[model samples]
Target chain A: MTAVRPPEADLVVADTAVQPSAPPVPPAATAVRPRARPRPAAPRRILMKGNEAMAEAAIRAGCDAYFGYPITPQAELLEWMARRMPEEGRAFVQAESELGAINMAYGAAAAGARVLVSSSSPGISLMAEAMSYMAGAEVPVVLINVMRGGPGLGSIGPSQADYFQAVKGHGHGDYRTPVLAPSSINEAVELVADAFELAERYRTPVMILVDGILGQAMEPVSASFRMPERRGAEWVLGGADGRPPRVVKSLHLKPEALEQHNLDLQAKFGRIEAREVRWAGERLDDADLVIVAYGTSARVARTAVARAREAGLAVGLFRPITLWPFPTAALADLAARVRGFLVVELSAGQMVEDVRLAVSGRRPVTFRGRMGGMVPTPGEVVDAIRELDGLAAGGSR
Target chain B: MERSVIFAGFGGQGILFAGKVLARAAMDEGLEVFWIPSYGPEMRGGTASSTVIIGDGPIGSPIVDQADAAVVLNPPSHAKYASHVAPGGLLVVNETLVLEPTGRTDITELRIPCTRLARDAGDDSLVSVVALGALVGRLRLVRVESARQAIRDTVGMKRPQVLAADLAAFASGYRVGSRTHGPSPDQEIVRTRVHHRVGVPR
Candidate 1:
């Protein structure tokens, strides 16, 4: 729950200086509540930060193990699973370094175990080379970048500054990877489950791009879930499948072979975009303004729409849960109904440019966002809504 | 229906644990619930608080900007959260810790010596539960049986000496609350925590 070692918690466990003893009360301290009135089982509930939710959703999506190094904003994901994954019969280990975690993810994915690696920007920078290796080898490992403010060791404040690194493909070569940008706790849960499926289908690395705000903010989520079942690893290069040995390695001195590999990867991404492109929509029907955003900024947009409605303005919201596939098709359709595109985010118009590319001048696209961990509020979005309405009055969106 | 309460106090007041127990009790009732705590600087002697939200509907926005009810353990909390309570909300304040009245006319408030109540019950650590008792008595949001079970689930019958005293302290709290006001909410928050008689993996 983004606990920074509260004083009360410290008092409860102050002796961590020494090794933590087995709990004073054994598991027996947890008593059994009788099933009264036989109601339907309660959905799981947790007051958890978004990063913890991502790790949990990863586990629920059949993550067999987690390979990660501790970093601010995202440290909770590792800490949560450290005690929890083993209880779920999964392996949770803190890698010696970000490089080690990324390589471990590569190995786990190659072995067909649902595996994940997560970090903030600085930590992610260290693993970019390994990420490329994973993509080059066609392994389906999920990597989460819970972004903090920065170009380097930015304070653990929220920022969408990693847009270029995530969507543009930070690693070398002409290869591309799929990225999912979840805006809310609910989407964070659903997107990771969907991400694992997409990764397996594409047989490529998938990035779940999250900001520090989403990483640290606590939200309510259903507590009980059955992780998706593990499936088809028949082709994984794990030495023996009782058949011919297939090795999974990223190595190519031959230019022709590497070019072919890139082509195959591109074909995979194209199929995914045509078939994928996940998004969340709101009040876009017969609207004069469409607010396009993702992650935490999108939530603020939702609140702004409510305020705009109260102010007698017609505004709708669109959140692209999947970033790489871009959801241009959905935005294009929304553009048909709305007067203009107002892209709001925590960075300097990264997603707004994508909105423009998608709308392709069919509608006027504009942006109002913050940088370096600053967040735009609902009032800011309301202003944008009013400005867009005024712009439409002049026969332009 | 969703019933949420915020528990706040200085460090060592067991307010956060109180919140967790409330959430756990709500869970035992087969209700969806969450226990969220405020993070303090990684140091000793820091103040802490937690918000536990229990509901039948999908709970939205875990951070409650305005609380329908609260259990405050310090004077500062009384000052901080007093105005944020919805009109006619239930307020359970620690008589031993909070020396001032919120002096609000619209809300129903019950003052109790929860710290003294817990200390008399042989565990000053249980003051949070004393506050919880008052909460349950005043609101009846959760069943009495559920409250008892929550206690047993949290600290079993093994400590038979404290078990009865803990239950009695809860009774004192509930009684104090009932004596102060009647149930006013249109819908009661029925909590349901899911647990196996034999332990299964959480």
Candidate 2:
């Protein structure tokens, strides 16, 4: 890893970050449960909001239980589930708090059920401890964070400021959770289904990070999914009736034991990084400038790119479908081919650091973004791209 | 061609519902559609607005800085969105609520007494449908037959009477729109490049 400055200078790094005592076990070997294939269903064209689509997608994925607290931008999701979960003969609970919701998720996941829990930024912060515990226990649960502005009871508007909070480890310990960000409603639906699949495959928690705008916007989507069965059934608590009782805990009393656990977690994460990286590249064959973005910001980047092309500028977009893996290799390759980079986002500059690290001094990378509920329009992105092009022209001369 | 429209009115004017109806109609016509509401505190008993984009291909942005057409239902809405209409674009004004004419002579402006027309049509709740009819009538952006079918699919099943009133109001507005002439230039100057699909790139 490159010597990069942490987002916060005084940030604390867990003591067990470096020590590894256990051998890496392959994820496939760890995953012994076979999932049921989803049968194709109808309702091929429906105009649904992003939040409602996510809720319906989860149901179609054969989610056994759903626990969530009502918060703006995502209130419709819980409401939809409350109306349909029971109809589908599944369990739905409106937990008293986000903390309660995630803990319930942990309980259901430990018992080997396809579980889903969702919340916004502030609510997500409340579940940090539970997330850490889930990560430590190696439980497979899917969480959806429809991000809004933040720092302290921020406005209920679209934002991506939680990038670091999601990818840089939300809770304590030296562990990472796979994070997927979707730019469109259809992509959000597909990613939510894949999140369950991935969580079970790695036997770890996975998060789908989306913005408030995407959650509130409506578009036409074809709802189709094959439900994923309860993962890790062989070793789950409830499924252990005939076998020895299985215990799930994250507390490692001894330093060596905890270090071994950390090493094993790192190995699983490494495998995920190598095998689960996903991204989309556009018009990169012969482009002088590339814009890096994810989630809703990528949509604006595409609009900006079209306008820039109309103005005779060679600009393309590199969107990371999987934010945790950061699509570092694809970015590095693009960095070598392009003249410079511009990272556009809805946060001050959280993800830009990752882009810079990925480029690793091979090319110059700049950033343009907004925060605290403000969104950058396509016109603004076009202006930023023009400025980057000017810098590239100046450097080449 | 891509058509970006803005519908603005008071909280209970059914502005959002009208946008949804248009989106459904566009979808039925096999066009790409994106609908986004101005989800702010103002939506509570205050002015409400939504942006709907219809295109022959995938839409890039759900929100637009300027709209190709603006349908204003109230005076405040007209004041807020009148200037946002693109040059040489179309502006549909509900004259019963917004009596003042937009001073811009560069674009085509259609004035319809939607509230009065709805009252005359026997259901005041059909004002938005009247405005919708006028919008579809003028632009022909989506087929009128498709919009009629969308109305049936959306609210027709629940309230057959409301659907009947809405069809009558739509027919009145369509007549007014057909004879009123089309937008002056009939196209927006800022064209959206249609090479890339929404999330899936071709």
Candidate 3:
């Protein structure tokens, strides 16, 4: 790469140097009165598929634009947007490809519009480059990955194999996308509604990761949402009427300048990791083994934990709602008291690596996973827990 | 309390629709519910199924290895799911289509001629709805009134023309299920005959 530094590099350094150190204001606390718009009054409670509910929640969250290419499991989301986005007087485009869709999202988000882009495993892989660009540019964009089995065009069945691809960074460079995993349609809706706020607050991409099961599953959800207040972003690209033109780009040919940008990204990731780790626990206080899981696997593990409890086993479930920052501190704290840990996933083992890092050999972390779209049933997980119980009781690996 | 049901049949048998109806009814009755379908590249003759879980508390694991109840509308579905029902649970089979016996006696099995009943009720496509009514009639998973309301909300809103026929089919199945009991003395004789023919131990 050529080492010629653009003159705008100084302006970029000045812009990022002043990032606020204050903790982000929670979205609900900063909300204003609902906007006056004529639309159908949301039903108090209605049954909806996870894909459809998430799409609806994005609209309620004031997503100003949507760009996506249809893919299995998540195609319904794009289809829903196609019908509803225009009804709300918003922009919706069925881009020619995932690359095009993600770039459209990048452009829309850079212009200060709340944007949503969605795809499945292979589709997401196609968008990885643009994702890196958006993260580097520090533009707010919300992405939904309704994951399916995959290394490559794997299967259209539910899979969490993208754990590494999501939390560990799918694209190049040192960057982290805040990942929210939802096990149920209701939770998916709530997370989708909040994802926009999270992205805007951090000025980075936020991913809502679900699996095909959740996307296709139907459940009762309250469509009503507290609409987030819209505010003008200072960094967005508008006409350079009286002010100097702002540059939003990821290209930095000079090594030192690129290093500075990377450091800024790392610092922003640090703040996110410190402030945005979210998890849910059940029966963890007195448990000997905590089953660590997220998304659909977590739902199955919850049932397994409950069954193990009924069988008089001291078992609990720890579900990480945010896959990254990976709930490291919280899990480390648990590792101190719990005898061992059992990690479950819909892949051979991806998140288990993170759990191992979090536990740091303090407690043995055993793993149970299924690949190629086969989900571990609650009984299977319970069986795994029984094995872990024996190992924990024996005080052996 | 938590209960789960699996609805399985050939495609176009309204397998998913039946499960949705139960889930919707459960929701209307103020219970938490989940309905997940087996989705893939399948056409009209292929196997299709959906699982619905209803609970008083938060539901975990929408898919289950063994459901509390199952409604199987075709022979292949019956062969696949008959043993998948939990012990002491209910299995509602479409008698007109499922020729083989379930070969199990631990759980109450209702073999209603759902297709015949639906045909008599003026819509053969209501087979799944009839089986659904039979399931609710035996299990009492949700009130019959609530199920009726759910049909109005789900199927009625979609295909309003068939609403009356669907309701009628549901009533016919309900009547059959209410009058039937676990392996009537006559059915026991039939089960023994079937076991002997199928070479299955009683």
Question: Quick one: ranking by TM-score, best first?
Answer: 3, 2, 1
Each prediction's DockQ against the real complex = 0.08, 0.22, 0.24
lDDT of 3 by residue, A231-296 (tens): 668889977899999999999999999999999999999999888878877677778789999889
* Among all candidates shown, the one with the greatest DockQ: 3
DockQ of 3: 0.24
Q: lDDT for model 1, please.
A: 0.71
Candidate 2 per-residue lDDT, tens place, A30-123, comes to 2111122213331346688999888888887778999999998788889888888887789999999999999999999998889999888999
**What residue runs in model 3 are displaced by over 4 Å at the alpha carbon?**
A1-43, B185-202
Q: Model 3 clash pairs?
A: none
lDDT of 1 at A313: 86
Chain A of candidate 1 scores what in TM-score?
0.85
Task: Go through the candidates in order and give each one's C-alpha lDDT.
Answer: 0.71, 0.80, 0.82
User: Ten residues in a row with the worst lDDT in model 2 chain A?
Assistant: A15-24
Error of 2 at B73 (Å): 0.8
- Encode model 3's per-residue lDDT on B82-177: one tens digit a residue: 999999988999988998888898988898777877777777788898888888877788888888988998776567888888888777777666
Estimated TM-score for each candidate: 0.73, 0.88, 0.89
lDDT of 3 at A218: 91
